[model samples]
Target: MLFERVESEGLAHYSYIVGDGNEALVIDPRRDCDVYPKMASKEGMRITGVLETHRNEDYVIGSVELSARTGAEIFHADGHLNYRYGEAVEDGMRWKVGRLEVEAISTPGHTLGSMSYLLRDSGGEPWIVFTGDALFAGDLGRVDFMGMDRAEEMAGLLYDSIFDRLLPLGDGVIACPAHGAGSVCAASIADRKWTTLGIERKRNPRLQIESKEEFVEDMAVALEMPPYFKEMERLNLVGAPLLSSLPEPSPLPAREFAIASVEEIVLDTRMELAFGAAAVPGSLSIWLGGVPSFAGWFLPYDKEVLLVDETGDPGEAVRRLRRLGFDSIRGYLAGGMVAWHTAGMESSSIATANVHDLCLRLDRQEKERGWILDVRSGAELQKSGRITGAHQIHLTELPERIGEVPMDRHVYIFCGSGLRAMVAASILKRRGWKDLTVILGGLAGWSSAKCPVVK
Candidate 1:
C-alpha cells in the first residue's frame, strides 16, 4: 500500500492519498487538487475516488476540483443539506479499491453529516481511519457552530462518535485527522502530524474525559467564527468552482500601481519590520506569514487584492489568499517597495515602542498619553491578565469596532506576541489614525520585563 499526506501551510489542513495496487483514494483535499493526482501517478496508481468527512468552514473544499481532474467520484455522508456534487454515502456502506476495503462510519458531531472512513488491508485487518473534524491528534472537534444552545447536544454526539464507534476499532489503526495544530478548527490540537488510536486513547486530554457530560462541559470553551465561514458554507453546498490550476496574478509597475484604482485593497506582504520602516500609504500590512490566519478576518471576498511583497514572492501570497476563496486578485506591485520609493510616491510608516518605553510613558503620564490596546482574544486574556488600563478588543473585531477606540489618545497595540499588534497597527494606519505605535514583544514581553498584569 502507498500513502502520502499533503499539508496546506498557513491553513494547517491535511489531505491524504492512499493507494494499493493500481487504485487510489483522496481524503479531504484542498482547492489545489493537483498534488493528489501527481502523487498517485508517482506511486503507479490511478485516482478513483474522493471523500470529504464534512463540509469545511475554514477553507474552500477541493472535492469537485479533484473529481474533475481525475474522473474520480466524490463521496460525502448523507445529510439535510443536499450537496450539488458527490454521492451521499451512508454508514456501514463498504467498497473496494485495489487491495483495500473502505467503509464509512457515521460520526455526526462536527457537522450533521460528518463521517469517518475505515480502511482495511486485503487481509481484512484494520489499517487506518480518516477521522475528519470529528477527532484530531490531541483534541476533539468544536460543536458550537450549530448554535450555542445546541453545542452541548452536538458535543454529546461527538462523545458517542469517539468513545463508542472510533475507540472500538482497536489500537493498531493509524489515526489520520483532517487538520493539525494551528488550525482554527480546534483549540488545542497536537503538533504531531499523525498518531495511532492507541496513543490518542491513552494520552489525548479530550479523550480522557470519561463521561459524556464531562466531555460536553470541557468542549464548552468560546470560539470565534471567522466572517468568511458563512460564505464558505454557502459555496461548498453549491459546489465551489473547479480550479484547473492555481491563479498567477500579474505584476504591475509601481507607477501604474500608484494611479490604479484606490478601491483595491493593498496587502503589504513584506516583513513586519520592512512594513514598519516604509510601506505604500494606506496598505494593510499582513506580512507573508500572517496571510492565512488573519487575512480572512480583514479581506473581503469580492474586493480585488493588490500585493506589495518587495523581498518575497507575491505569487505565494496570492495562492494563500486563494485557498480561502479570495480569488479576485488584481496583481502585485512590480519592483516592490523600492519602485514606489523611486517613483516619488508617498509612503507611510508605523512606530514601534519597546515594553520598557511604554511602561515609562505610562508612569510619567505624558500629555496625550496613549492607550494600550490589547488585541488578544478573550481566552488568552483570561489566562494571562491584561496590562493595567488596557482596552480589550480582538484583532478580528477591530475593523468593525474602530470607533470604540479613542481617537484623541495615542494607541499602542499589543497581543500575546507582536505579530497581531502589527496587523492591528496597519489597520488603524489605513483609517487615518496617525498617532499609532506597535508594542514590541506585546504582553508576553511586558511580563518577561517583570511588568505587572491586571488580573
Candidate 2:
C-alpha cells in the first residue's frame, strides 16, 4: 500500500492517503485539498474512496468537494446503532483490497461516529490497524469532546474500546493512526505516524490502567477549552464536509488596494520588524510571534480581505483565512504599507505595552485608566492565577460578554500572551468600543516580572 501524510503547520493538522495497487483512499483531507491529486498520480492509483475518522473542527474538511470532483465513495460509520451513512462501515465488516483485508471496529469516544480499521495481509498476522482518533501512539483521544455529560459516558466507552477491541489485536499489529504529534486533536501523541500495538500496550497510559473510571479521568485533562468545539460538534453530527479546492488568493494592484481598503478589512502579513516600525491604522497585525490564528478569532466572515505581506507571501495569510471559509479576499495590499506611505497616505503604529504598564495600571485601579479585560480561559485562571484588578473573562465568550465591558471605558484587552489580546482588542473596536488598546505580552509577561496575583 502507498501511504502518505499531508501536514499543515499553522494548524498542526495531518491528513493521510493510503491505497492498494489499484485505488486510493483520502483520509481527513485539509480544506484546500492541496496534495491528494499529486500523490495519486505518483502512485499510479485511481482515487476511489474518501474516509473521515470523525468530523474535525480545527480546519474545514475536504470530503464533500473531493467526492463531488473525484468519483470517490465517502465512508463514515453509522452513529448510534441504527445510524446511516453513504457507505456504512461497522464492527467486523470486512472488505477486500489487493493484498489486504480491511475491517471496521467502532470506537466511539472522541465523537459518536468514530471508527478504527483493522487490516489483514493474506493469511498471516493482521498487519496494521487504523486507529482513527480513538488511540494515538503514546496518548488517547480526548474524551471531553461532544458534550460533557455525553463526553463522560463516551469516555467510559472509549476505555472499553481501547482495552478490548484495539489493544487485544496482539503485540505485532502495526498501529497506523490518522493523527500524529502535529494534531491538536489529542494530548501527548507520539511524534511518529505509526507505532506497534505492542509498544502502545507497554507504554500508553490508557492501556496500562485497569478500570474504566481511571481511563476516563486520565483522558479528561486534554489541552484546550476552545469555544469553537460546540460548533464543531454540531457540524460533526453530520460531517465537517471537506472542500474540493480553493481559489488562489486574488492579489490587488497598488491602485486597487487603495480602492479596496475603503471597504475591506486590512490584514498586515509582512515581517513583524517591518510592521512594528510603520503600520496601518486599524489594521490587524499577524506576525511571526503572533500568527494569524489569534487574529482570525476576531476576523468576521463577510468582510473583503486586504493582505499586507511585503515579501509577497500573502498566499500563506489567505490559506489561514480559507480554513474559516473567509475566501472573499478582494486583493492584497501591493507594496505593503510602504506603497501607501510613498503615496503620502496615513499610517498608524501601535505601542507594544510591557508588563510594567499592566502592573502600574492594576496598582492604580483607576476607573478611567481604560477597561481591563482578561482573555484567559476560566481553567487557565484557576491554575495560573490572574491580575488582581483585571476583569475575569475568556476570549471565546467575548461576543456574548461584550455587555460587561463598558462602552465608555478605553477597552484594554489581554490574554496569556499579547497575541490573543490584540485579537480581543480588534473585536471590541469593531463593536464600536472606542479608545481600544491590547495589553501586549499578557499575564505571562506580568508573571515573569513577579507581578502580584489576585488568586
Candidate 3:
C-alpha cells in the first residue's frame, strides 16, 4: 500500500493518492493535475479512480479533469447518496485494492455528502480514516455548508457522527483530514500532517464539549467564506477545463517586460510568502491566494505590467495571473526589489495595527487623525464589537468607494488580523491616496490589547 499526502500551501488544502501495485485513487484533488500522471508512470501504477468527499467550496477541485485525462471513473456522493465509483462504496460496505480494504463512513455534518474512509490491511485492525473536513488533527469541521440557520442541527449531526462512526475506532486510527490551518472551513486546526483519534480526543477543544449547542458556538470562529467560493462551486458542479499541461509561461525578457504585457497580459507570479516577507513600497496588500483575481477585478487596466517575484518559483505568480487573463507580465521586478532598494528607490510599509492599537487610537482620540476604516465582511460584523465610529465596508469594494475617504486625514484600515485591511490600503494607495496604514493583528490584536469592544 502506498499513500501520498499532497499539500498546497497557497490554499491550505491536502489531497491524497492511495494505491496498490496495480491501481491508484485520488481524493479531493487540486486543479493542478499534472504530477499525478508522471507519478503513475514512475510507479507503474494505473490511475483508476477519483473521489470527491463533497462539492468543495474552496480551491477548484481537479477530479473531473483527472477522470477525463486518465479515464478514471469520477465518483461523487450526490443523488440519494449515490456515486459513479468504479467500485461503489457505502456505509458498512468494504472496498479492496489488493490487500487493503476500505470502508466509507458517512459523516455528513461538514457537508451533506462528506465522507470518511476507514482502511484496514489484510483483515488487520483499522489503521487510518480519511476524515474529509469531518475531523482534523485538533478540530472538527465547522458546520459551514448548511449555513448559519441550521447550525444547531448540523452540530447535532456532527456529534452523532463522531460518537458513533469515528470515536469508536480506538486510538490507533490515524486521523487524516482534508484541510489544515489557514483553511476557513475549520475554526482551529493544528498544522500536523497526521494525528491519532486518541490524541485529538484528549486535546481537541470541540471533542471536550458535551452538548451540541456548546459545540456549535465554540466552533464559530467568525470566518468569512472565501470570496471565490460561489464561482468555484459553480465551476465544480458542471466542469472546469482540464489542463493537459501546466499553462506555459513565456520567458519574459527583462527588456520586453512592458511591451509583452501590452501585447499579451500581466501575471504577477511572485510567490505570496516572499512578498509578505518583504514588499515594494506602495505595493498592493494582496499577497495571498486569489491575488490574480483580486488584482484583475480592481486594477484591470494594467496592460503593460511587470511581475514582482520572490527569489523562488517566479512562475507561480505568473500562472495565477494568466488564469485570470493577466498573462501580460513581461518580466520580474527587474532583479527584484533589491535592485529597487540598491538604486535608492523609495519603499514604504503599511503598519499592521491590532485590536489594541485601535483601542489606543480610539481611546486617545488619535483615530480622528487617521481615517479608521473597517474592511471585514458583513458576516464578521454581525456578532462582533467593532470599532465604534470606524467606517465599515468590505475589501472588495474599496477601489470603487475609496474616493469617499477624505484625503486630508491619515488612513488606518484593519480587518480580522490586518490582512484585508492591507488589501484595502493597497487599493487606496493605487488610486493616489497617500496617508495609509494597515492595522496589524487587526481586531484580534485590538482585542488582546484590552481595547474597548462595542458589541
Predicted model with the maximum TM-score:
1
Worst 10 residues of 1 by lDDT: 442-451
What lDDT score belongs to each candidate, Candidate 1 first?
0.84, 0.68, 0.66
TM-score of 1: 0.93
- Reference-based lDDT, residue 174, model 3: 87
Q: Please give, for residues 1-455, the per-residue lDDT of candidate 1 as tens digits.
A: 78889999888999899898999999989987778888899989999999889988999988888888889998876456878888888898887888898899999888877999999988999989999999899998888888888888888888889989998999989999999998899888999877999999998999887688889899866687999998788777887765545456778888788766387888888777788989888888887788988898998877788888966367678778878888788888888888888988888899987887787777666464567788998878888887777888999999889998877878888886577888999999888888888877755546423336876
For 88-133, candidate 3 gives per-residue lDDT tens digits of: 3456655666677667788878776667888776676798788888
Better of 2 and 3 by lDDT: 2
Q: Report residue 186 deviation for candidate 2 (angstroms).
A: 4.0
Candidate 2 — which pairs collide?
61-242, 61-243, 62-242, 62-243, 63-242
* Candidate 2: residue 383 Cα off by (Å): 9.5
Candidate 2 lDDT, 1-455, residue by residue in tens: 77777866666566777778887777767666757877887878777887667656566666666666677887765345332235666677766666666777888887676888777876845877878788888888887665566766888888878878887888999887766774667766777656898999998866887777777777765466554444444444444444433356665666667677778788776544455456666676666334424544555656877778867667766766666456667677666666777877777553446666866765576455565788887767878887666797787678778889998766667676666666566556556766666666645546423236766
Structure candidate 1, residue pairs in collision? none
Could you give the C-alpha RMSD of every candidate to the true structure, in order shown? 2.4, 4.9, 6.4
Which predicted model would earn the best lDDT?
1
